[model samples]
Target: MNAEQAAFLLAHALPPEARKDCWQRKFTRAHRSDLKRLGVTDTQAERLARILPAIAYYGTHGPSLAAARTPLVILAADAHKAAAALRVVLEGRDEAMQESRGRLLQAIESLHPERCEVDPARASFFHSYDHREPEALRLLTALQDVEQAAQHAVGCMPKAQTRAVAHTYPVELIDAALSLDGPAFHVSASAESKFRRVAALCYVAAGHGEPLRAIRAYLRERNASPEN
Candidate 1:
């Protein structure tokens, strides 16, 4: 094991668990020899241990864990530096999400002055036809309508208006709303096929293809049809 091996192990070992106490304990005891074999010095291994929890949290919450981890593995000056870089990446993600939330609020406010007020205390009312029933179904239907309208608008708009509104609330919010359920099974199947096609690209980007290929293959096979 060398630096490349160490990076590979770190990439795969990041678990989805939010609380990393068990992962940390097991990682320290079980992987010590492997880490040493990978040419990670004791000090570097300690730095990795310290950062594992944050890495795990960020991995589970972020849009693309592979994309988030790519820079750390590729660009960091050393193992310790990589750990610090991971923290910065996660912080940037948090800041971006905060900015998106602010933009969402501003967009909603701009729709007002039609003499309508949203009671923060009665936020549920917007979603609910029945006061006692939170209207998740209603919200989903509304989101679908928004997505359809946005797609049509984007298709019809002049290139300038399309580009301008690309950053606006309708496009962003509709996308966010639609993605809330994650990808559908058929879409996920398609994505897995696409992922496999791009495995080489990911490998070139990350300097290793095995982990990504393994994950993509798993997704593909998991959704594979018996007839096909």
Candidate 2:
């Protein structure tokens, strides 16, 4: 089998369980000839064995998985940031809240009937009671309500945010081939060349679309590159 035939075989030859496990112990030094028979060099086969799991992972999830997940990932991050900010506010004596309270108190004090002349509209209504006292009471009541709301938010916030989150999904096979970039999918230098080719073929094998002409053109460019 030539490289093209080998690529086709590699797309479907491995067992599902073995593919899922990335053919870990399944391919050993003893199976070098098996890979050689499929037109893969011993060095290339070794690299291929190492990268199979990543390829299988991409196959299982498909190319569009990352695009589908990106928006939700960003939203979750925003929520986490908002929650963290809220936690900071509720977990301590908030300086801003204290500042606001001070301002409100000063305003209420300045508006007191004793401090300043009461407005005619205010002086006429139940002239016996001071409106400042009721206003202060209402402010305190509103503060209590805010405190209760903050407590509820504290209870609702996640106890521990995951330190490591894979917000960006691994780059797909077709994408890696098209871009000639696969670091996101962990494609190592040893396996880079053949892996990109086979990965693109596998993507086509999965019935995604007729991109063979583009794939061929890309391969030609890679072959002509100084790095290749």
- Highest-scoring model, lDDT: 2
Clashes of 2: 0
lDDT of 1 by residue, 1-228 (tens): 134433444445444663446433224353556555434455544534544443334323233544544454443234344444433432345777656544544544465433234446766735642221223233334545554554454445443311111111111111122223323112122434432222222222222223342443444553573734
Could you tell me which residue pairs clash in candidate 2? none
User: What is the C-alpha lDDT profile of model 2 across 57-176, one tens digit per residue?
Assistant: 433433354454455555555555655554443334678865654565568777664644345566665456444445566544555555555555545655444332221111222333
- Candidate 1 contains a number of clashing pairs equal to 0
RMSD of each: 25.3, 16.8
Provide the clashing-pair count of each candidate structure. 0, 0
Model 2 misplacement above 4 A: 1-36, 39-44, 57-218, 223-228
Q: Locate the minimum summed-lDDT window of 10 residues in model 1.
A: 163-172
